[model samples]
Target chain A: MVDRHLFGLGLRKPHYGAFLDGAEPVPVDFVEVISENFMVEGGRPLDVLRRVRARHPVALHGVSMSIGSADGIDVDYLRRLRALVDAVEPLFVSDHLSWSRIGGFNAHDLLPLPYTGDALAVVCANIDRAQEALGRTMLVENPSSYIHLPGEMPEWEFLDMICRRTGCALLLDVNNIIVSASNHGFDATAYLAGIPAARVRQIHLAGHSQGRALLIDTHDRPVPPSVWSLYAAALERFGPVATMIERDDDIPPLAELLDELALARDIASDRERRAA
Target chain B: MTLRALQHGFRDWLTSESGPLAGRYPAGLAVYLNTYRAQLMACLSDSYPMLVAWLGEAAFAAAAATHIDGSPPHGWTLDAYALDFPVTLDGLYPEDPEVAELARLECGLGLAFVGPDAAAVDPSRLGNVDWEAAALHLAPTFRLLPATTNAAAIWSALAAGERPPPAERLPQAASIAIWRQGFTPLFRTLEAEEGEALALIRAGHGFGALCAALVERLGEEHGPARAGAFLGRWLGDGLIVDVN
Candidate 1:
């Protein structure tokens, strides 16, 4: 098991050097890496992951599991991912709750799925296969959305049902919850309330791009205040779940991101006091 | 629709310019389409920077959009997503073979950067080889590419942030060789003689057979000498994995 509470940053290429070198005691407890990037057989990518893993606990966050595809999971992909897990020995593995590939063609984007019973079964089955193959319980993060189908169940209910059926944990991205609420016309707080707090094992906080009529989870900017508000609410319900700040584009210096991570630490620090 | 049908529908929309969502165009549909194009274009541009540098954004983007639609990523890693983009570039400018060559060189560099690791062949161990039966194993990251145009020169200049040299076809057939040396990607033009030998070596030829082919080109007196010289260069470049 991980610590009682931990704060981290999504490890990116731009910050690779600063992270490996002794650049004076960085503040993050653990680092999360995009698993597919380090699924290589051998190279600088795997080397760097090993060096960082020596210092901090690593969480393997994946983007291409396509866990909701009714066609079933890819065995080769699972093998490679399992190989990486053996090498890195990460604390736990995670991927988005959305599907990425279809018909053997990887769209390379996290596409939205309709919240239905059939979709739930597909996702839950895939999760069971993944967990069994990985030899551990996996966390599934909620994805930001662009569209949805009619006659579907609520998003929170879908997430909650996935956990109940598969015995998998959730990696709730507070910003995704906020972005989906804005795009699908649902209340964010109610979305939070619907989730079983005990099942949420981690939280993701990131920035978004506001288009003319929709919000995009771009993950390029600093954490905005609205997302922070949602995060505080998440802390209230799921106290001290492993928190991480993810920045993929326009990445600033490590110091700038450390400041944001500090803010997450402060907010999570208050959850216990507030509950008391 | 079934979950499978819904996913296929989503894919159809992602690859189509006519919008993927049904009914009234929600602003969110535009959001998805715009991000899809922008993100895929970025991946293609990163894969073939020199080609985009030479073709400029407007032209590259037009071809890239087509490539994205026709050749959706078959691999999980986006780094591997644009592997076949040079085919699109080749079709776009069939008259200019250099366009495809440039893309090949760029793609080769990316592959070499992430390919499997191997120990460089030891020069001290070179002399113990039985030439009659020894086969040289090339590094996994090593790539040998035939070139007719000055694509290597153009790729080099663009990679260095300099204006490309004048584009012209070479008088003789040339080749580009790339391999990673201690985690850094390195590429250079291979000599005509060495380039021919590389092709034979990659085709699983033994040392004695490689020398015989060199003898066919360089005569008996200098055949063994020339093959030895090329072997030395490959060893120094860390391109040889082992001798078996």
Candidate 2:
């Protein structure tokens, strides 16, 4: 985990110039990037990442780990990710607790997983292989799902078991909690209460769009009021975890995102003062 | 359902026109299907902007939909999904050969962008080498894309945001050489003689053979001179990684 409560933003393409060539450093404590984008042999992407790493701490977040695959974790993917981790020496490495591949066919989207004991065993085995291969513990984030597969336990219970069995931590995505809770008719606050609070090492704050039947984790807009409230509650529980905001589409100016990071800092500060 | 059975069910629903997983996931089957298709489409559209421009937006969308339905992604990286699209274009627009050729060029450039890096052979180091027995090793990113039409010109025009010329076939076939120079991926249309020599080198031929072949075709006097010129150009282009 990071040294302390850190606020950061996703280092996207449009803001690469600003982050790399600015007169002053971007004010965030760290920057997160999609790991798959930089998992290349060598190119401009690696060059840019090296330059950026010189300025700020980076977190490697991936989308294709498919930790819940029934067949098994992709050993080749783990090897490449381990190489990237060795190069970046990131503050944290994380991927969603969802499967995108099964039987060699990768759908390339975060597909949902049932919370049954059998699925849990598969996930734990995969995480064990990943952590062993990477030589570092991973942070698995809960995903927002539109379909609620019938399972033996709630999502929080499943995550608690994963943390216990695989010795991995949590990258709690508050936005996902809201989206999934609303879609599956679970209590969002209850989820925050149910998770292993000490296991949360980082937190993701993002925006979502309401689809016809469910909330989609779009990450396009600013962190809405609802998500902010949950983030505050998460800080109260998780206690100053590393926080970052994600905006993948229709990106605005970097200053706007910094302002959002400032809000997160304020929330953590408020929680600390209340504790005092 | 068992975990394996459930996954196969989801795959079938996502990859085919089949109904929603035997009514097990009716709530968000449409969402998963939409997300799956949209992600693949966006990947293709992003990877082949030049092709998307050459083929209008609607036609490209239709082609992307067709490709996505028939081809499920198997690689961990979504970038690999775009590599096979040129073949799909070949099947879709066999009459317009430029379409497939343009897609191939785009895919080659993309691959070269992230391919293994190697330093070009230093000219100073080449001075004492035995010219006859030395084997020419090209950069790992080097790719030879066959061309029978003016696809390279179309790609260049579209990349420059200029109006592309009408698709036309070349009177003679040629090849395009793609490789990275420093950090930039580059491509050049190779002359027929140069293409054959490069192909020979790529296939592990020694410098003596290239020289002998050029000498055989262009005769000894101009052949050696032409071989020297090719060496000079390859070294300058950062294509020759090693001459051992």
Candidate 3:
């Protein structure tokens, strides 16, 4: 488990210039960078990441590592990822709690896992392998699923089993919980309450879009009012964990995102004050 | 079931029609799987919008679905998944040179976006070098595309959501240079002689050798000076990484 807590925002491209100029530093504890964006040979992305890393503690949020795939982990991908982690030296590393490949082909989407015991074992082993290769404790974030697997344990139980077995950490995405809960007809609060608090090392709050039948975790809008409420509940339960706001599309100016991050910071600080 | 067997079953279920495994999932499982297919198709479409526009959305979706069925995702990153698309599409659209070229350009753009970051050599770094003997190191972000067809014009038009003009019956081939100068990736059409010069330089030819290639192509009278001018423009454009 991580000792220090964080309150940060996702480092996005639209905000790169402002972020580098220090024109709009979000009043948060740190920042999280999408790992693949900066994994380049040389360009503005790395330059900006270097500048931001100098000012704030940064954590890497990876999209590809397909940790739950049936095929053994991609060794070359792991090597490149390891090289990046070493270069960036993030607070902690994390990827989606899903599989993304089958038969050596990459679908690129974080496809939902079956959540069966067999799937759990495969995920745990993959997590163990990733952690060993990375030489650091990595967090796994729960994916927002539109459907549940038959005979699968509750998502919370699946997460609990994995963390207990692999010694990995959790990056609890509050928006994902609300979105998944709404889609699958589960109680969001109960899902949060069920998690072993000690395993949660970070929190991700993002905006979502409403689809015809399901709430898509789009990360393209403001944090919904209910997600904010859920975030407060998460803070109350998890204590001061690393929190970040992820906005991937239709990105507002940096100041607007910073304002949203400030809200998360205030909630965390307020909760800490009450506890004290 | 063993992990391997479950994986095989899941792959078969995903790629082929839903059969016995249909019993294992709830009524919503089909819905989820259908959504998954749509999502994958949407992602592929978004990544290769030009190709979709060229092939028409229906055809593009069919081809993308076929590709997905044969090659399931293995990497955690989506960027790498579209890498082999051009090669795959080439087989399907063998008669359509436009289809293959547009796919190649889209894949190239995706690659440029996720390619490794290297420290760009400041132009001032070349001040100490002798221009005649110096061999220029192209930035890792630079890519030279030699084409027998007008791929760049078609790509630009397709990207802008417009249909390209009909291909001209020209005997001469064209080449394009794709590189990320800052954050944005750029594509510029290169003259035949210029492309040859860059190819020589990329192959570790010295300035003299590059000049010789330019002379052989453009003729001795204009070759050396034209090549010199081209190098100057390339350096100014930040395409050259080092001169050693």
Leading candidate by DockQ: 2
For every model in order, what is the iRMS? 1.6, 1.0, 3.5
What lDDT does candidate 3 reach at residue A225?
93
lDDT of each: 0.85, 0.93, 0.79
lDDT of 1 at B82: 80
**Tens digits of per-residue lDDT for model 2, A1-276:** 555699889999999998999998899889999999999999889998999999999999999999989989887788899999999999999999999898889999999999999999999999999999999999999999999998999999999999999999999999999999999999999999999998999999999998887889999999999999999988888886899999999999999999999999999998989999
Top-TM-score candidate index:
2
Q: Per model, state how many residue pairs clash.
A: 0, 0, 18
TM-score of candidate 3 on Cα atoms, chains taken together: 0.81
What's the lDDT for residue A246 in model 2? 92
lDDT of 1 by residue, A160-249 (tens): 989999999989999998888898889999999999899888889999988877888999899999999999988888876789999999
State residue B236's C-alpha deviation in candidate 1, in Å.
Answer: 1.2
- Higher-ranked by lDDT: 1 or 2: 2
DockQ of all predictions against the true structure, Cα-based: 0.67, 0.78, 0.40
